[model samples]
Target: MADAVFDEETNVLLSQVDIEPVDANWFDIETDFVLSQFNLDNVLDMDVKSGNFPYSQTIGDLNVEANKTETGNCSSKRFNFEAKSSDVKKLQASSTPLNTQKNTRWDVNTWDDWGKWRNDRTISAGLKESAPYVLVPPLTVDIGAAELCHWMCRFILEVRRQDGSEYPAESLRQLCISIWRYLRDTCRRYDLNFFDRSKPDFADLRECLDARMKELNVSINKVKKQAKPINRTEEDILWSSVFSLNDAACLQYAVYLYACKLFGLRAADEHADLSVTQFTFGRDDVGQFIRYIGGRSKTVQGGIFHKKVLAKDIKQYANDSNPRCVVNLFQKYLSLVPEDGPFYRRPLATKTADGDQNTQHRRLVSIPYRSSCRECAKGQVLTASRLDTLVK
Candidate 1:
């Protein structure tokens, strides 16, 4: 049911065939079913398809290439979420843009790269020159490029493996990397990329993303689709009125509200999309349900993090009697959570741009869905709820 489609209107990837909405988290069918139909299992652990890169070259003793002719999906200017790419014709990872002080995602591929271009030895000159006040003491929120670079480098290498396996060590790094990647993009739009770009080679990788962007730009659906996400304009919890009706839709919204207000978590990767394990209780601190925590984050780049789902609302919605298939990976066993898993998830956001609607559009509705799913509060629908409504 899921075939490749070329949509001339949006220049976004589409399917020759229509795919039914099995769920927001994953494909409706099992991976085995898909693999059987496409014979993909036979291709694993093998060489990838061949291709020609027109922009191949050498830079600073490293072989380089661009994704010049590769096809783009949701990363075009339309959405702006970036993917860790292996394409060559896109852009030079080291090609620092004019007027921009930091490097692109493609430029740095090793710890040595961090030492030189990223100013790993100390704080970034860029931060000191611009906002000196922000750098005077123990940097709290606004950070410099150097420290961020070092942190990101360390985190990435912690989980990065030559074997290309998503083992325990690697998964943690990926989760952190994924979280930081979305945060980086958010900061960029909010004028914070200088301190927020912690994604693996975001600066360098982004440099080589231009071609892919262009290609993807030519494949999306022009104009927002009707089914796009419907994000709100303010942090409105007015939906609490559903106290008496704890039905599926109401409970879903309540859980969404808790995610936005409580954890401020918003991610679209596998960890968030799937339902978390749950258990029932009585008059307990966790109330009725408890979410499964200790899962990995998608942007971990590297490093292990064990997060506890220490929230009240989340406990009520754990996968149990009223389970809505919501995933709660951070419940317990933080040590078991992978680094490359989704930190928070829901439906994909409506658009990549700063829009009120976060989940109205369906298919690749802007890269926000790829990055941060629509937040259920604080720019989500506003509603009032009786505390008992969430009790069960």
Candidate 2:
């Protein structure tokens, strides 16, 4: 009965209410017998008299608006992985409002604001007072279509930044496509038909843009390189230096870094609550292990569950405090953290008002110490952007 209601294996449940049982004649009970069990008079009862439903409860428009305001609140609490947004806000298409809202899930006002940002462009002077880069000295709406198209082509192919750096071929191709889209949108807005392929001017302009994009694609394909995975030697070198760092600042983050690598965990938006509450210690076929449960990482979204596990090893890396040992490092971190708090806290450091030139020399000679747990924010956790700096 529970499996029929909700299936864990399939991650699905019945959505519609079972108003009437389909297979009513079962266990010696006839369909008519089952129908007779119902109190037909209840249809006239006061409870049934109201034209309301059990499944849906009506709410005020104000409440609906208030709920909508909290829709994007998750973005604020997201981990700054790569310092970029990773939240998946899917676009939806709808009709009945006349099918005008195709892939219009995004707010129109927000889209307009972003479009303004995309349209804005500026060129800055570089070092040594170099000439500022410009695209055809800027054009106005009064400019002839032919002249505008000519300059647009010139901008796409020849223009460079103040630093004497031309746009990448792939990027320039995208820019060309965007310009074409802008032209179409503008024409549509003003009830013009300049983009009609049947028109001679439109066909010529389209051919020109298409040829330019093909040229860019050729260049892009020529320079394309395949990304390769990191080798064991490279990993060893990176981790060795990280674990052996003498500075307290380096050691402070080394523990978390080691743990991440061992458990195949991304140092970002994976764990919703990376506190002790999610941790579990148990034994498997490989012996004692630590498990992290219920973290909706990007690697496993949807209804899928992800659990990170660290198995106990027979051989320890070092007799003393070794930052490379995941088990030891995790235990140390756990001891410092409270029963329920952030697994990784911010590193601590004191600053001098008047810095000395011997700062580097002093750091080199300084003995590493444990990061002070007392200095950490009560409920705050380390972020991926900070992890990137530490890795660097």
Candidate 3:
């Protein structure tokens, strides 16, 4: 009887199940079951609560309140954007204005200082009253090429040495060249149209300068006497004489002579400006020597024109066995002098007076050799004049 009841129930379930064939576009069709599962009202209510749907009216009065709040937020954002843009415009208006007057010439004060120095040089050279060709600021004065040529001729003819003697041909030529350089540089800086080589006046000026230089050279050569150079025998005699003397003054003179011979130092300010620090003791494969560190020289003045130029290396070798060894003399001199003072100093001495029956005799009193601190304090050194007279 249970089997009969199970079969009847299975048959009844099968008869109630509807087995229909699905269409080709079955996913596109929305059946009643899918439509009933998704509620549009609930989705609209959720969107309104989350403020995603601005036109949602399912919550009637709340919709109007939400719209008003959203409108105020948008208005506030627009106002902030407008305010930022206006502030940017105001900043641009108040910023520093562009400099309309473009300055081509650099450093006005430097040019003015140069003008003053040129004036002083002219006065010292005794050409101020005669030539009277003052260099003013560029573009302010109109100096023609002819005028420049005339001024330079006058300068060359009238310039004299401190002893009131005429300048040598070389010196006059150099002065004229320097003056032309100054004028050319000044014209370039101020963008003036002067010293044009293409023009006839400039050509004529150069021709005149060349002709005058040739004539001056010829005249100077006729009168100027050539100086004789000291021979090796004379140099040996000088060295022996300097070495024989045991006085402090003679020792200093020996050191000066050695420095001039070994280092090729000029008879001018090179010896005057020397300090103790420039020399260094070093040794190489050859032998031991004292190295001299070269600095600003006559040809190289450490200016912009001499950039990246290496200074010359001057060295004096040691001759320990020799009586007039430069190294030994220098070391002995160093031992006698102070560390901080100049390389050259004045040797000190004392004087004594002896009274006899008829006359009183004053003589130099002998004392230990010492350099004078008072003379060094007075800025005195071995001048070129004294150096010239040492051997004589």
Better of 1 and 2 by TM-score: 2
Assess candidate 3 and give its TM-score to the true structure.
0.47
**Could you tell me every candidate's TM-score relative to the true structure?**
0.22, 0.35, 0.47
How far does residue 324 in candidate 3 sit from its true spot (Å)? 1.4
Overall local distance difference test of candidate 1:
0.35
Clashing pairs in 3: none
The CA lDDT at 259 in model 3 is 70
Every candidate's lDDT: 0.35, 0.43, 0.54
Could you give me the TM-score of model 2 versus the true structure?
Answer: 0.35
Q: How far is 52's C-alpha from truth in model 2 (Å)?
A: 33
For candidate 1, what is the total of clashing residue pairs?
102
Among these predictions, the greatest lDDT belongs to: 3
lDDT score of residue 20 within candidate 2: 62
Off by over 4 Å in 3: 1-142, 150-171, 181-200, 217-227, 243-245, 350-392
- Model 3, 1-392: lDDT tens per residue? 34654675465555555557777786755655566677788888889889998864676577778989989989887555555787876764433222211121222333344456566776677664454355533323466655655544444455565477665666655555444444444444332222456666556556666677687777775464432343455556545544333455666666765676566665444655566677778899989888888766655456666777877688888987877677777776665555543566655443223211111122113211113211321232433332333332
List all candidate RMSDs to the true structure.
29.0, 18.3, 23.1
Per-residue error for 222 in candidate 2, Å, reads 7.4
- lDDT (10s digit) by residue, model 1, range 1-392: 22235545544545445667777557555444544577443343132322232223323213222343232433464567554564432343223222121222222233234334444333554445564233222222455555554454343433333475322432333344443443354244333243234644346433333333354346543353232222332212334333112232233444544543333344433224433342222344544444333223333212323233333234333455532223332232112223333332334334324332222212222222211223433333232221112321
What is candidate 1's TM-score against the reference? 0.22
